[model samples]
Each structure stands twice: as C-alpha cells, then as structure tokens.
Target chain A: MAAMIERINVLIQYKDLLRELVVRDVKLKYRRSFLGYLWSILSPLLIMIVMTIVFSQMFDRGIDNFPVYLLTGSALFEFVNSSTHMAMYSVLDNSALLKKIYVPKYIFTLAKITSSVVDLVFSMGALFLVMLVTRAHFSLYMLLIPVVVIQIYLFACGLGFLLSAANVFFRDVQYIYNAFTTAWMYLTPIFYPIEMLDKMEWVRWIITHLNPMYYYIQHFRDLVLYGRFTDAAIFWGGWLFSFVVLFIGLFVFKKTQDKFILYV
Target chain B: MSEEYIVDVENMTIRFNLASEKVDNLKEYFIKLIKHELMFQEFLALKDVNLKVKAGEAWGLIGINGSGKSTLLKAICGILKPYKGTIRTVGTIAPLIELGAGFDMNMTARENVFLNGTVLGHSRKFMQEHYDEIIGFAELENFQDVPIKNFSSGMQARLGFAIATMVKPDILVVDEILSVGDYQFQQKCYGRMNEMLQGGTTLLYVSHDINSVKDLCDHAIWLDHGVVKKSGLVEEVAAEYMNENR
Candidate 1:
C-alpha cells in the first residue's frame, strides 16, 4: 500500500512533464502531414468506408446499423492497437534521456497512452458523423461511453507497461506485437457479427467469457450502437479484467525497470 | 544520512555484464539459457567508491576517458542504481548531462524550451515566468519559432543549458556540457555556474579541461580506472593529474 501511494505521488509530482510529453507527441504525429490533425478523423472514416464496402455484402447477417457497429469496434480496437504499439517503444525511444536524467521511466509510457487517448477522442468525431448520417438512434445510454473508455484505458495501460519494459531487453517484442495485434483484431468481432460463429459454440463461449476486448467492444456497442444499458455482469467483468491486467503489467514493469538503464 | 552532507555515497559498486554474444532476441537468449551456454564477463565500472559532499561545495571529478567519471555522477543523480551499498541525496537535482537529450528535433525552439524545462521537473508556471530570461540568455530570441532541427548544434546546446540553469537547483550535475557552445557562451555558462555556487547549491561537475577544473573547483578527486587515485585541494590533484599525463 505504501508503494502504491508513493507511485501516485510521483505521478502527481510529474504531471506537468507528462502533459508536455503528450502535447509533443500529439503535435509531432501530425506536423508533417498535409492534412495535419484532420487525418485523425479522416483516417478512421476512410477505413470504415472501405471495410463496409468489402464486408457488408458478405456478412449482412440482418444486423442493424452495420457501419456504426463496425466503427465502434474499430475505433476502440485502434485505441488499444496504436497506444500499445507506441508504449512498447516509449522506453526504447527515450533511451538517450533515460540514461542521463532521473525522470520516472513510467512517465514515457503514460504520455503515449494519454496522447493516443487524445487521438481516440478526435476519432469519436468521425464516429458521431457516421452515426448521424446512418440515422442511428441516440439515447441516454450513450452517456456511459466514457465509462467503457476508462475501462479499456486501464486495460491498455496494463499492456503498455508490460510491453514497454519487455521491449528494452528484447527488441523483437515490437515486431511480435505487431503480428499479435493483427491476429487479435480478427479474433474480436470488429467487422463481422458474432452470431456467424453460432455453429462453433465453444469459440463463442471463449470469446465472450475470456477475451477482455470482447467485453469492452460489446459494452461500447451497447451504449453507442444499440442505445441500451449493459448487463451488470459484463460491466463488472470489464473492470475485473482491466484491473487484473493492470496489476500484472505494473508488477512486471516494476520488477524489471531498475535494470533498464544498463540495457537501454 | 547526516544533514551536513547534501550528497552521501558509501561503499557503492556498479557492475556491468558484458554478454559473450549479442543475444538481443528472446528466442536465442532462452535457448542459450536452457543449454547453459550463455556466458557473461563481469566488468566493474566503479568498485567500493565512497564520497560525501557538503552543501554549497563545488567538487570536480577528473579522470581519463572511461575512468567511470560519468558513471559515478549518474549514480549520484539516481539515474543508475548501485549494484551494492547505498547512495542518499537531499533536495532536487538538475542534471545537465548531455544537454538537449530530451529535445524533439521536429519541435520549434520555443516548444522545446517548455518541454525540456518540464522534463527537468520545473512547473509550467515556473517556465512561463522564466521564459523571457531563458530565451535572452540563449540569445535565440529571433529563432524561437523555428524548429530546433534547423538550429545549429551550438544553438540547441545553448537553449538546453539556459533552461536547465534557469532556477537554482539544490544540486546540479554537469557533465562536459560547457564544451558545446562558442567561447563567449562558455564564459557565460561559467559565470552562471559561479552565481549558482555562491547561492548555496552543491555542484558535481565532470570535465576534461584540467585548467577549468582547477579554476572552478575548491576540491578535486582524480579517478584512475574506477578507483580514486588522489583527492584533496584542487591544485594538488590537478598538478598530479597533469604531471602523470605529461
């Protein structure tokens, strides 16, 4: 408990530095592009359009509001995808500064996650535009979107901590993660309906019961696309999975961080 | 942990394991570990070192290349953990070890000032208050909006030094940053160091210029291959170091 409090104090003390790092990341990410910040919204919109054209005809399985459904899953998964990838390299990228100064190492990973959160917010603008064009119902349940976002943020933070520390010792973690995320996206019901796996009951059970992203994406689709309240079990399950990963990530990261300077 | 000593290091040792082969990937490392084929040659960077610095003292560390001068400074600044023993330091430390290590090349000079300042643990309000002073000190008032990548190496170094020394830190760890800028700017940096030293800030400085070490430090330690060879008055240590080199 004392250790946890100390960590929080460090976070609060270095909060300003964290904000600066996030701003630098968000700015540099778009500085060279002609579209600049517009690409945040446009990139996801374009991806949604292409996916809709290619998959809509094949998996039209009587699902209502397919674009909104596809986008909610895509945007949420993209947040997890990009944030983890960025965080995995956060420690390695700042090896120069890390070797010289005493800034808390975890701050780099936190900044990457925060900046990706900022991008996720902008992508929501695209999601909203699509929802309006498709005339999807807007209900009070949409207010709970932030809750789902917080849960997934915790989940990604866990993975970020784990990956960033592991990357320092093994540079191959980044390439392996890239391939893993691609496979993970397919496993999650992003561009297709979950019912399509009805013939395989065990796979459906595993996805619903074991996959953390499935719960998050489903919670998101519930609030945003279906305009209905989520099941209490699903909500609690999301929090449980997120906290489990977060604690494990923090554990692995803390155990290995002291040796980072030597390797980095 | 005495209050009189602002910096205390006792029986500290730093070890580095030189891997026999570069096993960067996990698969090869695991395979080597399982087969008991992984070998590491132990290299001691600093062995059983002890030092204490009182408040308001400027101590110079003189050594040849790879004598573990930078390693000791890094250990004191809490950047590297001691492989054995303990290091205790009081108050905040501003490390100028390799200035501009935190600067993003693509960001403008003005943005880098705030970014680097925050990295050094200064609040935004503190940076905002000292923004004009930093820009003026670095003499880059005209190029504030230009990306730092376009700035000459000297200009970037100047900006880094200005921000780091803007506030009087309780402890300042400088590692050969004075060699970057022009002679005039080096003079300016020395002047700033003198001012801070007079204000009761403890300084741990590492530099190759023996003349500057003798000029700026009241006490000095000569390190030979991770061991303290001689220490005491700056004149004696500097004379002995120079005599041996000649």
Candidate 2:
C-alpha cells in the first residue's frame, strides 16, 4: 500500500515530464512528412474505403450504414493496436535516457499511450466525417463516446505496461506482438459482423464473451452507429476488463522494472 | 537517515548476470530454461560499497576504465538498483550522466530546452521563465530554431550542460559530460559548476582528468576493480592514484 502511494506521488510530481514527452512523441511522429498531421485522419479514412470495397460484398449481412459501422469499430481497435505497439517499444526506445536518469519507468509507456490517444482523437474526426457523409443516426448518446475511449485507454495502458516491460528482457516480444495483433484484429470483428458466425455458436460466443476488445468495440458501435446505450453486461464488462488488465499490467511491470536497467 | 548527509549509500552491492549464451528471443530462453541449460555467470559491478556526502561538498570519483566509476555514479542516481543494500538520498538530484540522453535529435533546440527541463522535473512555467537564460548560457542564440540533429556534437553537449545546471540542485551527479566540448567551453562549464558549488550544491563528479578533478573537488575516492582502493583528500588520493598508474 505504501509503495502504491509512493508510485502515485512520483507520477504526480513528474506529470509535467509526462506532458512534455507526449508532446515530443506527437510532434516527432509527423516531422518532415509532407502531409504531416493530415495523415492521422486520412490513413484511417483510406483504410475504411478499401476495406468497405473489399469486405463489403463478402460479409454483407445487410447491416445498415456499413461505412459508419466499419469506421467506428476499426477506429477504436486501431487505438488499442497502435497504442500497445508504441508502448511496447517505449522503454527500449528510451534506453539511453533510462540508463542515465531516474524517471519512473512506467512514464515512458504512459507517454506513448497518451500520444496515441491524441492520434485517436484526430482519427475520430474521420469517423464523424464518415457519419456525416453516410447520414448516419445522431443521438445524445454520442457524448458517451469519451467514456468508452477512456475505458479503452485504461485497457491499452495495462497492456502497454506489460508489453514494454517484457520487451526489455525479450527483444522478440515486438515481433511476436506484431503477429499477435494481426490475429487479434481479425478476431475483433472490425470489418465483419459478429452475427455472421451464427452457424458456429461456440466461436461466436467465445469472441463475444472472452475477447476484451469486443466489449469496447461493441459499446463504441452501439453509441455511434446504433444510437443506443450498451447493454448492462457490456457496460460493466468494459470497465472490468480495463481495470483487471491494468491491475495485472502494473503488477507485472513493478515486478520486472527493477531489472530493466541491466537488460536495456 | 541523518539530516547532515545529503546522499547516503550503505553497503550497496550491484550484481549482473552475464548470460553464458546469448538468447535474444523468448523461445530459445524458455527452451533452455526448461532443459536447465541456461547458464549465468554472476558479475558484481559494485560490491559492498558505501559512501556519504554532506551538503555543499564536492566529491570526485576517479578510476581507470571498467573500474565501476560510472556504475557507482549510476547507482547513486537511482538508475541502477542495488542487489543487496540500501540507498537513501535527500533533496533533488540533477544527474548529467551523459549529456543529451533525454534530447530528441529531431526536435529544435528551443523545444529540446523545454523537454530536457521538464525531464529534470522543472515545471513548464519555470522553463518558460528561464528559456532565454538557458539559451544565452549555451551561446546558441542564433540557432534556437534549428533541429538538434543539425547542431554539432559540441553544440548538443553545451545545450545539455546548460539546461542541467540552470537550477542549483541539492545534489549534482555528473559523469564525464565535460569531455565533449572544446577547451573554452570546458572552462565555461567548470565555471558554472563552481558557481553552483558556491551556492551549496553537493556534487558527485566522475572524470578521468585528475587535474580538473583536483581543481573542482575537495575530497576524492579511487575505485579499482569495483573496490575502493583509496579515499581521502583530493591531493592524497590523486597522488596515490597517479603513482599506481605510473
């Protein structure tokens, strides 16, 4: 308990450092690029167009507002995907700084996730643009979007902590995570309707019940596309998954961080 | 735990495990572990080391290459954890372990000053107030907008040193950062360090240049092979160290 409070105190004391690091990450990401920050919105919009063209015919379950449906799901998943990937490399990328200074080790991972959240907000503009173009339903429930995003942020932070700490010891975590995310993206139903697996009830059940991302993406779609609040189970499940993963991530990271200087 | 000592390290031991074989990936490491084939040779970087520093005192750490001089500085900065002991420090620490460690080369010099300042735990408002002072001290007034990558190495080091000493920290831990710039800049850095010392900052400096160490530090420690060979006044330890090298 004392350690936990001390950690929080450190976080508070270094909040300014965290902000600067996030700003640096966001800036350096777009530096020297011709399109610069435009790519954040454009890349997702372009992916939605291609995926809509290719997968629209194959998995057309007569879902209304397909572009809105696809964009909402893909955008949320992309946040988790990109944030974790960036967080995974956070420690190793800052190895030089880590070896010299005493900044909290988890601060690097936190900064990466925060910067990716900035990108997520930008990509969200693309979602709204697609909604306007497609003339999708608009409801008061849209304000709940930030709540879902915050939940997803917590979930990604947990995974970020776990992966960044693991990466310090095993350089192969990056490659393995790359392959895992590809499989995870397919499993999350970003481009397809979950009901398409109706014939395989067990598979559908596993994806809906077991996968944490499914709850977040589903809640996001419910709010943005369907104009309704998520079911109680999913609403609570999203929070549960986020806190549990965050707890586990913090536990593992604290256990392993002391050894990080030796490896990094 | 006394208030007099600004830095206290007691019987600290830092150990590293040198993996007998290089295992870069998870699969190979797990396989070796399952088969009990993973071997490690224990290496002690610093064993049973102890040091105490009072406020407003300057101490120099001198040793040959691989003699744990850098390791000791790192341990004091809390970058490396001790395997078998405790380290307690009072007050803020400004560690210039290596200049430019926190710099983003792609960022402009002006941006880096803010970034590095925040990394050292200064508030954004404080950085804003001291922006011109830091820039002026580094003497890069005309190059503020240029990316750090475009700056020469000496320029980068100067910016790093300037930002690090901008505030008088309670404890300053420097590790050979003064070796990068030209002789004139080195003198300038020494001058700034001297000013901070006069302001009652405890300094722990590591340098191979004995003459400069003697000039800056009142007391010194000679570390040889992770052990304290001799430690006393600057003149006594410096003479012993020079004689042994001769």
Candidate 3:
C-alpha cells in the first residue's frame, strides 16, 4: 500500500512532463502533413469507404449502418494498433534520455498511449460524420461510449506496457506484432458480421465468448448502431478483461523495467 | 570548515553481462537458449566503490577515456543501477549528460525548452515562469522560433545548458557535455556553475580537461581502470595525474 502511494506521488510529480510529452507526440505526428490532423479523420473515412465498396454488398445485408460499424471498430482497433506498436518502441526510441536521467520508464509508454488515445478521439469526428450520413438514431445509450473507450484504453495500455518492455530485449517483437495485428484484425470481425460465419459455428462461439475486442467492439456497435446496452454479462465481462490485461501489463512492465538500462 | 555529507555511495559495484556471440534476433536467441549455446562475459564498470560528497561542495572526477568516469556519474544519477550497493542522496538531481538529449530536432528552440525542461522533471508552470530567464541566459532570444536542427551544435548546447540550470537543483551531474560548445559559451556555463555553487548546489562533474577541474573544484577523485586511484585536494590530485600521464 505504501509502495502504491509512492508510485502515485511520482506520477503526480511528473504529470507535467507527461503532459508535455503527449503534446509533443501529437504535434510531431502531424507536423509535416498538409492536411495535418485532418488525416486522422480522413484515413479512417477512406478505409471505411474502401471497405464499404468491397464488403458492403455482402455484409451490408447482415449489418445495419455498416459504415458506422466499420468506422467505430477500425478506429477503436487502430487505437490499439497504433498505441501498442508505438509504445513498443518508446523505450528504444528514448534510449538517449533514458541513459542520462531517471524518469519513470513507463512514462514513455503512457505518453505514446495518451497521444494515440487523442488520435482516437479525433477519429471519432469521422465516426460521427458517417453516423450522420447514415442518419443513425440518437439515444442515451451513446452516453455509454465512454465506458467502452475506457475499456479499450486500459486494454491497450496493458498490451502496450507489455510489448514495450519485451521490445527492449528483442527487436523482432515489432515484426512479430505487425503480423499478429494483421491476423488479429481478421479474427475480430471488423468488416463482416458474425452471422456471416454461420458455417463456422465454433469460430463464432469462440469469438463471442473468448475474444476481448469482440465485447468492446460489439458494445460500440450496440450503442451506436442498435441503440442499446449489450447483455449485462458482456458489459461487466469487458471491464473485467480490460483490468486483467492491465494488471498483467503493469506486472510485466514493473518486473522488467529495472533491467532495461542494462539491455537498452 | 566543517562538512555535511549529502551523497553517500557504499561499496557500489556495476557489472555488465555482454553476450559473447551476437544473437541477431529473438528467434536466434531462443534457439541458442534451447541448445545451451548462450554465453555471457561479465564486465565490471565499477568495482566496490565508495564515496561521500559534502553538501554544496564541487567534486571533479578525473580519468582517462574508458576509465568509468562517466559510468560512475551515471550510477549516481540513478541512470545505471549498481550490481551491489546503495547510493542514498538527499536532494533533487539534475543531470546535464549529453546535453539536448531530449530535444526534437524538428521543433523550434522555444518548444524544445519546455519539452526538455519537463523531461528533466520541471513543471510547466515553473518553466513558464522562467522561460525568458532561460532564453536570456542562453542568448538565443533571436533564434527561439527557429528549429534547433538549424542551430549550430554550440547554440543547441547553450540552450540545453540554460534549460537544465534554470532551476538550481540540490545536486547536478554533468558529463563531458560542455566540450561540444565554443569557448565563449563554455565560459558562460562556468559562470553559471559558479553562481550555482555559491547558492549551495553540490556538483559531480566529469571532464577530461584538467585545467577546468583545477579551476572549479575544491576536491577531486582520480579514477583508473574502474577504481579510484587517488582523491584529495583538487590541485594535488590533478597535478599528480597530469605528471604521471605526461
């Protein structure tokens, strides 16, 4: 308990540093682009357009408001993708400063996650624009979006801390993660409805019960598309899964961080 | 004069275990692990070192290249963990090691000031309160809006030094970062260090220049091959080191 308080005190003391790093990341990310942050909204909108043209004819029948569904899923997943991938290299990238002074090592990962989450918020502009185009209904269930966002954020933070620490020892982790994300995208049913997988009932069952992103994404779809909360079990289950991954992430990060200076 | 010890390092040792054969990737490493082919050779950067620094005293570390001067400083700054021992320090630390290390080359000098200041654990409000003072000291008011990449290395070093010293830390760890700047800026940095010293800041300075050490520090330690060879009055230690090396 004392250790936890000390940790929080450290975080509080360095909060300004954290804020500055996040700002630098967000600004540096879009610095050279002519469109600037517009790209954040545009990239997802463009991906949704392409996916709509390719998959709309098939899955559009099964999934209502297919564009909005794809937007939310892709945006949420992109948060995880960019956050984890960027955080994976945070330690390696800041090796110069890390070698010079003592700043909490996890701040780099936290900074990466903070910037990616801000980007996710910008991508919401694209999601809402699509929702307007589809003339989606407005309801109080949309208030629940923050809950889903928190789940995704915690889950990404967990995975990011885990991957960033692992990458310190193995550069190959990045390449492996790149391939893993690609496969992970297909399994999450971002483009197609699960009903489309009728022939593969076992795959569908596993996705429903086992996959974590499925709950968060489905909760998003439930709120934005169908205008309702998910089953009570999935809602609580999503939070549980998010915190569990977060716990493991912190555990691995704290365990491996002291040895980082030696390896980095 | 009496002394109040503010930094204590007790029998500290730092060891690095280097892989004998480079395993290029995780796959190769795991393969080697399974086959029992992984080999490591341990290198000690510091061997059972002990030191104590009095509050507000300037201590210079003198050593030849690769003699663990920088390693010892890093260990004190908590950047390098010792293999065996404890370093207890009773004050906030600011390190000027590899100056401008936190800088983004593409960002303007003004932006980097805040960025680097916060990286060093200074609050944004503190930086805001002292931004002009930092710029005034760096003499980069005209170039504040320019990207640091375009500045000469000396100018960048000046900015880094200025930002780091904006707040007087209780303890300052300086590597050989000042040598990159011109002689004029170097003098300016020395002036600031003198002022800081006058205000009761303890300094752990590492430099190859014996003259600067003799001029600035009252006490010195000469390290050779990962161990302290001699330590005492600055002039005596430096004179003996210079005489032997010459």
| Leading candidate by DockQ | 1
Pairs clashing within candidate 1? none
lDDT of 2 by residue, B179-203 (tens): 8999999999999999999999999
- All candidates: DockQ: 0.81, 0.77, 0.72
Q: Which ranges in model 3 have alpha carbons more than 4 Å from their true place? A: B1-4
C-alpha lDDT score of every prediction, in listed order: 0.91, 0.90, 0.88
DockQ of 2: 0.77
lDDT of 3 by residue, A82-135 (tens): 899999999999998898888999999999998998999989889999888889
When candidate 1 is compared with the true two-chain complex, its DockQ is 0.81
Per-model root-mean-square deviation over C-alphas: 1.2, 1.3, 1.7
Ranking by lDDT: 1, 2, 3
RMSD of 1: 1.2
For candidate 2, the per-residue lDDT at A95 reads 93
Residue-level error in angstroms, candidate 2, position B106: 0.4
Clashing pairs in 3: none
Report the TM-score of chain B alone for all candidates: 0.97, 0.97, 0.95
Decoy 3 TM-score against native: 0.97
User: What would the per-residue lDDT of candidate 3 be over residues B1-246, giving only the tens digit for each residue?
Assistant: 113578888888989887776564798998999998786678888888888899999999999998889889888888888889888888899999575688989899989999899888888999999999999999998998899889998888888898888899999888888898888888989999999999999999988988888888999999898898998889899989999999
The TM-score obtained by model 2 is 0.97
